[model samples]
Target: MASDSSFDIVSKIDRQEAENALNQARKEVEQRYDFKGTGASIEWSGDSVLIKANSEERAKAVLDVFQSKVIKRGISLKSLDSADPVASGKEYRIVTTLKEGISSEDAKKVSKLIRDEGPKSVKSQIQGDELRVQSKSRDDLQEVQRMLKAADLDVDLQFINYR
Candidate 1:
């Protein structure tokens, strides 16, 4: 019998790369002429990112710079989920979510999606923040990947650790 080929389903971002990108963005914000006097700042805490600026436009500009840095560092733009700005005195703050791994709900959703829509040769099992999908033929796994990509759900997804 042929051995099953398997791969992990995940949405992992390299935290080190993200931090490096954040540092670069911070430097640009500090040195930029308009931002220098605007009291704008970007900070990351746990899975949340915060941006503060004197105005909503300034905050958006800072977010743009941050997005550019993230792109330069090879991070997917889909990882960010920014919220609308909230007022705080003369400044405004916006919070963004750095989505890394799947939650239990998302894992279950993925598992169900695969079982319902995947090829007959494919099978999937949820494992913590990831799902393991297996097939007797590598072609089935490739097809599964294509199907998932075509679905394009809100959460970022990546295929990894294929064996």
Candidate 2:
């Protein structure tokens, strides 16, 4: 039998880099003339970020700032998923989701996807936030990767650690 090739699927972020980007965004907000007096603020709690501003426009501008800063810092924009604006009086708040894990549902979906569409020699298992796929043939594993890339899972995917 041939040796099995395998890889782990994961959604992880470099917390240090993310923090650096956030800090830069805060500094820019403080120095930018338009954001001044707007009482705009950014809050980071656990895996989420909250942006608050006096108005919806300002809130969006803050999001743009964060996006630009993260991009400048070489972070993927896929790391942030922003929610719709919520109004509290004259202020608007938008919660930016920092995706860090693949949920059970997504994991199951990926596992099933691999089982259904993967090469006949490949097998997959859902392990918490990740899906492990393995096959006796390297070509089968490569084909699995190609199939996964074409699947619509609404999440960013990466193939790694193949042997």
Candidate 3:
């Protein structure tokens, strides 16, 4: 009998890499001549990152620098959730949060995609924030991975623990 081949799908970010990117963004914001008098600053506030500047445009510019650093570090932009800058007293602030783990609703979407479009021999089960896929054929498993990667999902996915 052929043994089952399986893998788990998850959405996760490397905290160390994210922090490195944040540090780089902070350094650039502090040293840039234009930012010197703009009161631009970026820093971690609890579990979220805070970007502050004298105006909305300056705050957004700071966010752009942070995003560029994040991309250079090979982190997915989808892992970070940000919203429009808002006024806070005399300065504007943009708060960004690092996203990790697939929500239950998103997990369900992946499971449904597998059940509807994947090879009949393949099976999927949602385990908390991760989805597990199993099949008798390794090729089918690979095919499913390809399909998932091609799907336009909001969260970044990673496959792991294949056996």
Models sorted by lDDT, best on top? 3, 1, 2
lDDT (tens digit, per residue) of candidate 2 on 1-163: 5567888887777788889999999889989999999989887967788999999999999989999988888767876889998999988999998887788888888888888877788888877788788888888888888888888676767766667
User: In model 3, where do residues sit more than 4 Å from their true spots?
Assistant: none
TM-score of every model versus the real structure? 0.90, 0.86, 0.97
Clashes of each: 0, 0, 0
lDDT digits (tens) for residues 1-163 of candidate 1: 7899999999999989989989999899999999978989998866788899999999999999999999999998988888898889999998988888888897888788788898898999888888899999999899889988998676789899999
The 0-to-1 C-alpha lDDT of every candidate, in the order given, reads: 0.89, 0.85, 0.95
TM-score of 1: 0.90
Candidate 1 has an lDDT of 0.89
Count of clashes in candidate 1: 0
Write down the worst ten-residue block by lDDT for model 1: 147-156
Superposition-based RMSD of candidate 2 using all C-alpha atoms, in angstroms: 2.1
Residues 1-163 of candidate 3: C-alpha lDDT, one tens digit per residue: 8899999999989999999999999999999998989999999999899999999999999999999999999899989999899997999999999999999999999999999999999999999889999999999999999999999999899999999
